[model samples]
Target: MALNNTYGARLVQQETALGAGVQILLLALLGSATGMGPAGWLTGLVFAVASWAVLSRAVHRSRLSSFGPANRVTLGRATLVGGVTALVADSFRGSPPVTLFVALTAVALVLDGVDGKVARRTGTSSALGARFDMEVDAFLILVLSVYVSAELGPWVLLIGGMRYAFVAAARVWPWLTAPLPPSTARKAVAAVQGVFLLVAASGVLPVMADAGVVAVALALLLWSFGRDVLWLWRQSRVVRQQGAGRVLESVAG
Candidate 1:
């Protein structure tokens, strides 16, 4: 067991505090340089600081560092995604904002693998870590989907919708909440969907690129969802059979 010493915590806390201060200072500088003025810059600064604080707290409370290399990578990745999203939004203006957001989003989307790979390599896999990573990925997907919807229409929801629907299904069907083994294919599909949405957002792609990518993403999502649903169904059936067997044995006794 690890000692309860605050050594590691202090190191992280110091870094996090410094980061928050830098965000505020940078936002102030940007406000002064650009006429976005005090209000916009202050608002951006507040959001940046708040987001960093919350994520730091989450990492601490969850003791995610104990989770090993892959999970550490995942944590870094999610933080990076959230940071890049906010930075891109604040830094860009006018027609080019879309292009900038697209490029960063693509990088963030691809970097998703770093954490999971580290976790698997280090053998630090845990349910909490996996769920944490999944939730972060889901939120980014939702953010991108909503942004695209303004120009691309509701069909963009398909990318985001499946995730929410799965969460809802888990709530409604307890069996669906049961954990199954992870898959590389599922992760690849997620990356595909993310790339598709970001590409569509850039508007640099041809209609065919948008349509083709979206179709592939939707297909992957369908395959993933179908596999999970089936696995859940099988688990439920096995559990029911076990229960029935116990009752029969008791009655016979």
Candidate 2:
């Protein structure tokens, strides 16, 4: 048993190391193609190191014997996201290479669909894989939002920050951590955030039209989050009431 655990840990470390290697290689290519600046290099390096560390820890805790195919797909998507993030950071120095940025983001978003199917088909789905995928999706949207915010306004940040905000709120209100019932609508709303942001970033639309598209995305995200929060709040209230009822019964007895 101990030997198996050692093997699993070693395997996870190797996979994450390989992921970091890929991230560095992508950054090198971006630098060569675009003369990416120091900010881009720094940001990409930070992302690679952080991703490797966090993913290694998570997999170790989950005790997975192998890093599965679905996770590898998600990791690849994450590498693309790192490139996109570096490009966004570099944009502050000058105009971004819009075509390259869009291409990387597009591939990442498309692969977002592929990972789940791979997981379901392979029967290797795990909580760690799902969480890894969700975090990558969220970070990519956040990066895209930052890029668009430069054009639209800071108000555009709400689209990127909402999920992180919810996570912070959960720290205070533990009930917010409760498992939400799976809603297809919620998933759809989450999926479109990237698409909407990508369109806005593509610079093809008129400013007014781009703002409108992002505004709609924010509204949908607001509604989806509001519904989930309301559900959790109601569930918490029911548990409290049931606890009180039990106390009353015991007192009566």
Candidate 3:
């Protein structure tokens, strides 16, 4: 038990250190390529450290003996995300090299499924790991939305903010947090958000084409969220009715 505990702590520490190193390297690249300013560097560092803190907490809670191969892939993806974040921050100072920014995001998106496959193949799947993967995907989509929004208008933020809004709603309506059954449609919708956002940011598409692609992504996301919300509402209703039935039976007894 002591060995497992010690190993887990060390694993988290090592990964956190790696993330910090990547952040620094990416920062330097951004400075050279984009003329990143002090504010951009500060923002990127804060994002890197904040993400590390979340990973450490999740790892400790998981109590895993090692970081595992799957998690290593996720960490690699997260490193790429740090690079993307730094580039996005630098963009605020002035337009970043969009090609490099898009390339980092593209690699991160491609690796999204790799980590999940690695987890399945290696038998390392865990709730903590899944949640970590989902959040990274969410953050990437959110960042992409912010980048695209600068050109498309503020309405584009809805594409990125929807997941966060759902999470906030779950806090008020605990039933919304109920475990949802696996659905391919949900996965597909989530996957396409990054793709469409990438296309929008790639600058290869015409303005109308970008609008159309983003519109479709948003519609699918709305459908996905709507289905889940409806399912949770039905579940809550059933639970209430069952509780009422039990109360009536006790009174009769």
What is the TM-score of each predicted model, taking all chains together? 0.75, 0.98, 0.95
Least accurate stretch of 10 residues (summed lDDT) in model 3? 85-94
Greater TM-score among 1 and 3 belongs to 3
After superposition, candidate 2 runs with Cα above 4 Å error: none
Residue 22 deviation, candidate 3, in Å?
2.1
Off by over 4 Å in 3: none
Q: Between prediction 2 and prediction 3, which has the larger TM-score?
A: 2
For 1-253, candidate 2 gives per-residue lDDT tens digits of: 9899789879878999999999999999999999999999999999999999999889888988889999999999999999999999999999878899999999999999999999999999999999999999999999999999999999999999999999999999999999999899999999999999999999999999999999999999999999999999999999999999999999999
**Candidate 3 residue lDDT tens string, 48-115:** 88988888877777776777888888888887887787777767767778788888899999999899
Clashing pairs in 3: none
lDDT, candidate 1, 1-253, per-residue tens: 2554366556555555655665566555444544444345554565567756775776688654343556555555554455444543444343324544565566667667666676677777776667767876886787677666656678777788888898888888899988878788877788777877777777877877776777777788999989989988999999999999999999999
Best by lDDT: 2
RMSD of 3: 1.4
